[model samples]
Target: MYKSLLVTGVCAGLLAGPAFAQPYGYDDGNDRPEYARVIRTQPVYQSVRVDEPRQECWDEPVSYADPRYQNNVTAGGLIGAIAGGVIGNQFGGGAGRVAATALGAVVGANVGAGAAAANTPYVAHEGYEQRCRVVPNSHVEDRVIGYDVTYRYGGRSYTTRLPYDPGDHIAVDVDVQPRAY
Candidate 1:
């Protein structure tokens, strides 16, 4: 009887050993999976600035007058009048001298006026001046490209970087195991 009992115990141990070695929730059991919902999806980004420099050029005109012209007209008139008067005074005698003096003065005055008008100085000149100013041109550019995902699983919320956007829901795996003490 002791041999039969020992043989039965050994056979039972061998049969159960394979059963214990197999994973749980297999063979006769089924696994239930919990799925999470994608509550929201938002895009994340960083601001970047870019600058492009451009140069613009143009020409402007400037003008100026000669200073010598202003004084020359008056000086020429005075010199001409003095010369005319001296020449006229050298001719005539007596009563004729008096008449000649009057005529000379008149002639001198006329010559002076004519010379002044003829010598009147006026000149027009054209010149060009270059001017330039820098105008800063700027604009904003969007350099942000990313995504933030919010998911709900087992009555709890979780956030992570989702490479692809989960349409409506996400699948979450939950496993149960017996603890050894």
Candidate 2:
């Protein structure tokens, strides 16, 4: 009985390994990018007050930082295939079982692909905000002189101005980034 239990555990591990693993890559820390966009030219709002030095928020590059979780495509595929095969094989018997297993794998692959595609990319919009600060790369002054503000949301990038001077910290609304797995 103990040996059978051990075998079952091993088989389960092999079959369920993918489910236990994570399926996406996302930032773990909730912090602003290392760099911020400095206001270069103004189309509206005229000149920015230098005295109101506020921290600028800028979108960091994709690789600027790593994600919290790594995409487990392999694991997801394996899990889907196993689950699909088991479910598909239930109705079929003998020769039919083999056919069912094959069908299950195909269905599983599709399901896995669909699941991966469901994962969304980054997003920015109104209502939602992203807090940001000055990047270390800035060599201008001790305080933020200005920021190149172009807030984008719902597929629209709207250039705007800072209502208040950015201090040591500031909160800029950002769209929720989708998970990538």
Candidate 3:
């Protein structure tokens, strides 16, 4: 009986050795296979660009002009009117000169204003948003680093420098002002 008890005690101790560090059934060891160390790291180094979400703007007071239509409206109209009147003069003479010039000016102004209007903010709340995340690093150089960090402002995913560690907090960038673009 003594010999049997000793054997049972030794077996129990051997089984429980790991439990001393953790729980009875818990395994905190990194069970990654030896080959896992040679994990293939794709050189994509790609990461979700954590940028300010695409935002929509409404018709706001003219703070600045978009370079696209700026010249078209400001100088294009005046120049067009001048050209139109000169052409008008080609058709008529004497008083026709004044009349044609005025007509050309009106047309030019209208065209210029129309061109400017093209840049008018098409204001409609079509609820547009940007996709961003609170990233710790700029990009993934080797492996697809997992990220668990969440942002408060926008629901975006960001990779952290914490080496794929779980339960890490991250931040996002979302501060776009009118005419700042």
Candidate 4:
């Protein structure tokens, strides 16, 4: 009877061994680390626009002319007529001298008026003014944002995006579990 009991106990222990090895809802922290072969790699890029501020400057010409002396000739005409009448009195005889003096005064007044108009000096001012403006220079550039990696593990292919290049091989975590069905 004792031998039969021992045999039954051994059979029960054997049946329960698999159940204790893998509990239904427990983790033993037994994830295995393995390597996966890299199938292909491609670089991912992003387009970005950059704006830089710059100052643009140029010189503009400015000029001004005085308007006070533009059209006044009264003083010069009166002075010229008086001088012409004296010179004409010295040039001809009695009656002829009087006629010559009148003619000379008229001619001199006209000449003096024209001379005053032509000789008036105009006051001019010349200078430059500096003008400036701010302009934005913009340009577009392509930047590498990340890398797309394709790898093969356990006869299956997978693709993932990573921040850096994972050379020829990548480390993978493997965990074994029983199916729920």
Identify the leading candidate in terms of lDDT: 4
TM-score of each: 0.31, 0.27, 0.26, 0.43
Q: Give the TM-score of candidate 3.
A: 0.26
Q: Which clashing pairs does model 1 show?
A: none
After TM-score superposition, the amount by which residue 118's alpha carbon in candidate 4 deviates from its true location, in angstroms, is 19
Tens digits of per-residue lDDT for model 2, 40-132 = 333333443344445777654333211312244445567788888888888778999999989998889678756654563323333434558
lDDT of 3 by residue, 4-94 (tens): 9999999999999977765222334555321101112222244555434444444433333445555556675676677676666666678
| lDDT value, candidate 3, whole model | 0.52
Between candidates 1 and 2, the lDDT winner: 1
Off by over 4 Å in 2: 1-70, 120-181
Regions more than 4 Å wrong, model 4:
1-33, 62-131
Clashes by residue pair, model 3 = 45-140, 53-130, 54-130
Give the higher-lDDT candidate: 1 or 3: 1
The 10-residue segment of model 1 with minimum total lDDT is 22-31
lDDT pick, better of 1 and 4: 4
What's the residue-level lDDT of 134 in candidate 1?
A: 72
lDDT (tens digit, per residue) of candidate 4 on 60-157: 99876665554456656876787777777777899999998988888777777778877887677898999999999899999999999999987889
Error of 2 at 35 (Å): 81
